[model samples]
Target: MSSQSSKQMALVAFMQAGSTSVYAGSWRHPAADLRFLEAGYYADLGRLLELGCFDLMFFDDRLAMPGIYGDSVAEAVRTGARPIKLDLSSVLGVLAGATSRIGLGATYSTTYYAPFHVARTFGTLDHLSRGRAAWNVVTSVNDSEAQNFGADIHLGPEERYDRADDFLQAVTGLWDSWEDDAFILDREGGVFADPSKVHELRYSGTHFNVRGPLTVPRTPQGRPVVMQAGSSGRGRDFAARWAELIFTGDPGLEVARAHYADQKKRIAELGRDPQSVKMCPMAYVVVGESEAQAQEREGVFLNDLVDPMASLTLLSELMNYDFSAHGLDDVVTDELIASTTGIRGLVQNLRSHIGGTVRIRDLAGHRATLLQGPRFVGTPKQVADQMEEWFTSDACDGFTLAATHFPGAFDDVVRMVVPELQRRGLFRKEYTGNTLRDHLGLTRPEPSKPSERGDDV
Candidate 1:
């Protein structure tokens, strides 16, 4: 494991194959590119992040559009609020062909797809990308996503995590079926592979029963890197057991520090090296030549660009509840918290942020216009300074940069902030390794023997 003093901070570009990335109103920005369906759009962005020496470029995905608000998709379609989304797996192929060194990752839900399908797709991707592949594992949250998969409603958190645990075990087991030395191309000897080296995975679990081995061979990095972004208690526990990289969001520096420390402790308690698991918080940055200019840009995003109704619609979808009927000044009460089938952690965090009671209007603005996570809006030097403070203070191993505008938001960080970070000796100026595991300084896990396979479940 690398020591904190010697470790260079890692950076990942948060992206989505949609009209906008994370900022709800970004699609309307004059500089934002709306041709998301074109492969060339992603190819250009992938190369830019690689030029910046980022560890990875991750794409956040959802199976369905935001239609939970008022049980209608009208607001989402009208505002273009995450209504147009492309498949992440397909986008990964374009990125792989475009960049040589940067890690390419995409989200795939455990709840919607079969374990065998997920294992094979990512395994093939790792080989195609020459080991620069990562999988962001997630359990589908919204009811619309559940309906898309023929389920009437999304599973409860406890049931969802239980199924996810079994799903991962089956997937990893299949990945380990073929040893690294299983292939032996002895064409003259009339031999294609060593049958003895390839083993069948007879995995039987509560949620999945997958038989035999995955058709895909051992990839360049042995397997693709496993990334998770669960923030609930069950989510954190799942991450402790399986995730090599974890993503989270916190409103303040102190809260981020506490969450970081807690997650590290949990990983340590699970008998794993805390340093082996990197915890990254989402950071929204707006950089300019001067602090004043950056503030002005942020003001424009908040006041002029952001649409309050669109923001509320997005929040409603995320929380799995409808807030359209509530009055703007209505205070969230204890009964509402207890009755919500939505994300309890998110509600609790919002409650704490607003002193035990939250107004519907405030919550809407907080989630929509303002940055929901740790934010740094200033000159390049100031942005670097805040990142350095968080990095050195153990608040996070690094940050996942969320864009407020398409290439412009990323352009500022790569062209301006990255150079400053490199000058300060906090970030890398060039690529050190080819594989995603190598870039993150993680060891390739050894294939589990048949006798040791079932124990993970």
Candidate 2:
């Protein structure tokens, strides 16, 4: 476990395989690259992040396009509001060959995919990357995603978590099918592997039932480091149980500190070491040579690029509701709150930010800007100072850096901010180990039954 004095922050890059990032205005930035459709774009990104000595970079993905607003994809596509989403598996494959040290990850939803497929895919990735693999698990939202999978409706949050519990059980069981020493490669004896060491996972659960050992052998870091990015109460509990890294979007320093403390307490109550699970909030930074210049750049260049329709479209997509169905001034209601099947944490954040009641216009504005996360606008030293304050205050373990533009946003952070962080000794100066687990200070788990694994913390 990392003591407070010795605890260095673990940084990750929050990413998407699209033209823009979480910010709707990213693609329009004069410095933003528009070649997301090609493999080279992501390769360049991977290399840049690795050069900065970032711990991991995971692509956040959604199964369906943003078609909830006005029940059409036209506005989303026309404004370039996250309309394009390439297959993450293929993109990660490209990165696997491009970079060596930085951890490569991609989001895969448990709601749509089968456990065996997810287990096999990530297990193979872990091997191919030579232990530099991570998987961001998500219980998908959006009925449009359900529709694409031939389902008429999306499941409620309770049902989704319950199903996810079982899904994780089956997948981890499959990952643990082979022991560490299962593959012997005995040539003279004419045997490739020891059959006695390889065991079959005859898993029978509410959501899945798989019988047999996986095709792949035990992965180098046991399994790719498990990552989760949910912040609702149930979501927090789920993360405490499974995730080694948890990504969040707290709006300010106080909120972040509260969240960090709460999550740590929850982990401790579950008999897990609080330090074992790193809680990293999303940070949207605008770096420049001077603080005044950075603020000017954000005010003049970045903030103005958000189209109104893009804001409404993204809001509708995330809430799984139609903004066009109501007027901009319409007050948010209990019914409206209950109806959302999307990110419950985001809706809650919206409510808290509004205080009494939220309006459609308020939601639109927040969605247009960075959603419920602190945006650092300053020079390298100023940005680093803010980050150091948050780190020392127990507000976060680190940050999931969100981009305002593609290469430019990343380039600025790597070249300007990272060195300051390193000088303070709040972040790593160099990678000490190759695997994602090593990067995060987690132990390589031994093969064990699903019921017995998390018990040891």
Candidate 3:
């Protein structure tokens, strides 16, 4: 048995289907790919992450273009601020065909989609990917997304989580509709499946009522791995009950440590093994041949490449409040914090990071990186050292890496940083298993009978 201290770190590549990753102006970088809509682009990305031995590559998404900045889409379109969006499911399918080991994850909102559709979609993905699929469950945050879904306004956090609870129940029930041995495929017997093994999920809840057996059969892993990235009180509780993997963006190491410990405690309180739930926070790394070189590159990104207006646009969308109305020198106030309907945890994190007070312009640009997570800029050894410190201190199981520029940013890590991590024995040199659960050191869940099935968490 491996000792607790000897556990390997899990790494995931935080990706998107748009022209840029998380950074708004990254697309302007000469090395960044402009043709993100092409299937070959994602295929190359998938293969690269697999080459680096990443546990998974997740595609983050939004349902609508960000128009909350000044309540207009002009700035969003002009700055190329996540304006080009693609269907994540179709992107995942492309990624699935390109890579074999690295897990393919796609973000799907629980708010807009029916439980049956979500279930069938991910279940089909899991089958197509040969047990290497993951679902990044998200509660749609922006009012623009709600508007596209025909809602006059976005639901509050509590109500969203409440509906999400029902959503999870119905989806997992549908996944469990078919047992592992249900398909006999007997040609002589003239039967493709055993009727006795197939079960119906007659689920009725406040938000959804899904009934009957799912169209898809049982997947290779029984069910796709469930990942959640909410950080509020309700979000954490929901994650504790349901998520096998948790994503977060705490700005400081101390805060991340606290969040990690609290989540593990909550998991234990929920009668689940704390070791089973992994906490991976987002990180941006800029690596170079030397520390000074890395610093210079980082300066180019933050100073030259980043468009302050575009950055603020994303921040406004994330906070669900208009920041364009405020003067550049205006202080981020308590009233502003209280008025946001976006994400309470994110607002609180921003407040904590700012401490006393922050100017509108400064907060807008800097918080773009801070709000996403920590940023580490240095040589490969220095970056690896910070990662080791966080991993060893229990701040996180690993990191979900975000790119400052397309292939260049990722290439730097894969070439410079990954070797150092491998030298320290902190990361995998090669994948030992084909399934995503295996890559994460999680045991495959056995199929449960209909009567024996309880909560999916």
Candidate 4:
């Protein structure tokens, strides 16, 4: 929807080149369009997002394939079988080169990597992209990811988030290691960097100790924009404190509003501007010329589901539980669910947003009423209308576009839907800012004030 100022809502496309090759029966669709590890796949997708005037494209990643379903990797792989695993950062560079203006974001696990390394890697990417870079901060969730990192077990949820909080503090600290005026070319004295301007992070926390400074300086945005995907209570608090953009999966409008309200309340309670943290909900669009055509397309996509069982397995892995033990009719009430880990928070959010009578086991299998992810399906105008309602109603700050089928579907969105949004003046006709933060309307955050920092004992 366009604001009175004519600022249309923002769109971010989520894609992994291999997302089509396997995982969730994606390869089975006649229109799934799978390709080997190739740069052209990303290049083509990037061009589509650029054409659509999307604010950015983020690569959602996991360290390893799904290993939780029935405690075997066979189903996930046999379905050709999902995330089969690939390096997204190398591919992001190719996508960055393919398109201009559209921001690029990648998920990197803080639990596994040192904060200083995150500073250097994303800082370098920000430079490489000419300031169009975003980092989706995540603590690796599943056990498969842990084993891949050479650890026999995954850290407990609270412990992982504790480490994550410290990690981000240190990474951002490193980004600000060199002040804006730190580099001074004093030809007379033959000195380049002014020693007085550079300061050490000296980050010492319960989970990590990142010493002093980093090799890389800050990028155009001062730092890569911080993005996060967590709707749990603890997750929401963390987002309020650190995230500039938050992603969520609220299946219904009611859920969206509840989350929107909760986050805004928290943002206020934390004493941050309500506008500072945008709560963007995840949405997958399946567009057609007409409503009937869209429904038909949805049917075809469901029929094309390469492996029915694998879709459920993916959902199971997401919930961090075994959804297969029950049937589609099996029900979970408010009190029946429990978790030793803090994952119950996610479950509560899902139930509250999902609404109505829900069959616990239905979460598995091929097509669901809510589908595999949060969804919006209809003609372009119909979809745009829904987007407008959400944006204006404050249901979300924006939406993330996930391709139902690639290239063709995404192309339809750019060609058909984008023009409609433009006519309404809900979106930008041209690039407003050079950096991703500018595109997202975020002020570059300065270093912590002297008092915001804690003094040593």
Candidate 5:
């Protein structure tokens, strides 16, 4: 990493293709636009975040709708809890057309999709965006998502990561198949490309078997920047080996610092530079002209906008455990915790936050407002102060700002908080480079040689 005084923060906007943000109640905010189904909505968002000089804007996705709660999707749809999940590839195309600088990213599960398909899709996206594409790698969390892919059960954590490890190898191999200078485009000589310059992937792994080169040409950035948000040990290991941008959801400064150190150490142990992998924790910032005004803005969302049942439904979906079987006041039993196949890190964090026996209601309440990460509510300068402290304290490389509402929440940050950060010399006043790697201070990856390739291929 650069010295603390000179290291500028890498800002990312956390986005969703559905009705609300990660905060389930955000759609209920009067200021939030309800036209999320339209491509124009995301296009506007893309342009706005680009204006703010955000390094990247990525969409979080789930393969299936929330239905684990009482084994029904009725309550989720009725409460407007992410019932409209649009395919991100189309949305990302709109965003690529709308913005010129900011990076575009979307989630795709390694478990559900074929590696060749992912390599082609993101490679094409990188070309479309002129090297501004990123891919957030995820192993689908729940049986609901598994069933959506026609599987009877979700893989356990170990198995999921194991498959993901191979999945990444195959994808990267296919991406590396075409040398940067392979395309000749020489119609005069009738030689469109050079054969020796292009090679076959022949990637054969435990989870994937890719026969040859990807359909897409070499991308501008060599490959799309790899983003991962895995808090579990196996997940972290996978991230350490592959991820260039690591997203985290830490509740406070101390916890975030520890995670940062651990991840960096893991990366270093894997023979990679720790600074090459940027660590960004999610933060929900409610900025206003005054601290009181910001607090009021936050209060409305936490106290009024959120619906209890909607939160419970989300909690069930995320944890992969049906909370409906237990009463609101029921203790979060050890058995219940052990049975959770979803985000186990979230359950542990909740236990730490409670500092005692956790109840179903407590988890519901936590999920209702902002699932994880710290909430910063104050004047623009005050929020910047908090952000600066975290950045300089080895807590994170920067932040992935979560919006309480769409467009408007981003508008507030771009109009208010960004200026403060720029004034403080903590963030970029303008984008210094074109590609996503350039914005994030990452180097373009070189095409892999056959000798350097994994044995699975």
Candidate 6:
């Protein structure tokens, strides 16, 4: 447990606000509750994440239901399969008031929200949390969500990424609008502002044209930690440029390592420091005194409110196809899966386990996809061992903890697993830094370079 052994890391709890029910439908779990929208639930989670010696708690958000059930949205709503989705800013603001230091991160889709709205919401959050905030940037990739937004069809993958590039440019450009000292509290002369210090970002991009001097001043972290979670080819490029933390849903270590290396290389190629962007993978780490006990606990958790058929129905809608048409235990292929069917990214990764060892029903175990990420179940020591192995081998920068249920499941991780990790010196036992960026080891970005245009000398 020496500093010389290997580089240790940070942890962020992956919360979906309420009962995330990672499997599919664990809303029925005796311990699981659907009251995250009730406010108090997330306030408790915020405090719990900070108590665990964790750096932050990030709420993962998605715009629409999954695609495999069919083209219609009735299945997810009627079955109460991921029935409710909450507003990120509203929930995070509540959590901010509950915890003093733990960072709060939330997903905001670039493809849907306007840049000015994105700028104001997160900018305010960074101030409210005193710089302990991160923004998870995403592109809406589903038809149900598009329909909700008044679109006839979803944007093509490349177009979505393209729009995302323009969107982030406008948003970040807006974020840098005011220098830290733009607002002066000088009341003696009745002059409270310095107009010269504030500049506008007149950004005209492929999909957007925005002229902005953001209303709010600079945030606590300079700019809230810019985070990205996409892992596709386009995703990597976006993360390379803007993200300080890259949260992923990768399935295996080999693939994860490749992604890590490729991203770091890309960061350097973009003339940015490789260490600035920390790559983290999402995991459902179920720990116990012993491996057997952990597995038993996992089984119990899974048994409480799981319905494989409902999961299949939900999964189909997410991937955008009728996956229930296929047997729950059938082995699927790239040819077989789609975002409308089952997440292609997941089915592709789970493809290896399909032949004999991994059954489709096992994949469908609560309808079979492991939420949007992977799972790691074992004893506390064993989980620590796996974490250390992954860290040393460069599989990821660290881990993001996602619970199958709310407060209770997260509490278990904080109690049993966190201490074990601290004992191993794989994680810090106390808050070493005040700001979320400091804890995450990111430097404050420099203000944008002044423009040199046709009008400028």
TM-score per candidate, chains pooled:
0.96, 0.96, 0.96, 0.91, 0.97, 0.91
Q: Which tens-of-lDDT digit does each residue in 350-434 have in candidate 3? A: 5676577767776676654434588888999899988888999989999999899788888888999998888888899999998
Which stretches of candidate 4 lie above 4 Å from their native place?
A: 1-7, 21-23, 186-189, 324-329, 333-336, 340-346, 353-357, 365-374, 449-457
Residue pairs in collision within model 2: none
lDDT of 6 by residue, 1-457 (tens): 2333546687888777544555555565567766766888788778888898788788777777654365655666665667567888899889888988898899898878999999899999999888898888878656777778898777776788889988988888787777777778788987677876677778888988877778888888888988887666677888898889988776677767877899899999999999878888887787777899889877775665566656766555545567656775666554565334223555544554334555457656624435345567798777777777787888888888777767677888889888888887788889878889888888888767546111111
Q: For model 4, state the Cα shift of residue 84 in Å.
A: 2.6
lDDT value, candidate 2, whole model = 0.86
Tell me the spans in candidate 5 whose CA falls farther than 4 Å from its real position.
Answer: 1-4, 451-457
Which ten-residue region of model 5 has the weakest summed lDDT? 448-457
Once superposed on the true structure, which residue ranges of model 6 sit more than 4 Å away at CA?
A: 1-6, 65-68, 302-304, 324-331, 337-343, 352-374, 452-457
Off by over 4 Å in 2: 1-5, 449-457
Which candidate number maximizes lDDT? Answer: 5
Model 2 TM-score relative to the real fold: 0.96
- RMSD of candidate 5 to the truth, in angstroms, is 2.3
lDDT of each: 0.85, 0.86, 0.86, 0.73, 0.89, 0.74
Best-to-worst ranking by lDDT: 5, 2, 3, 1, 6, 4
TM-score-superior candidate, 3 or 6 = 3
Candidates, ranked, TM-score: 5, 1, 3, 2, 4, 6
User: For model 1, how does the per-residue alpha-carbon lDDT over 192-213 read when each residue is reduced to its tens digit?
Assistant: 8887777778789999998868
Q: At residue 342, what lDDT does model 3 achieve? A: 84
Listed per candidate, the RMSD to the true structure in angstroms reads 2.7, 3.2, 2.8, 2.9, 2.3, 3.0
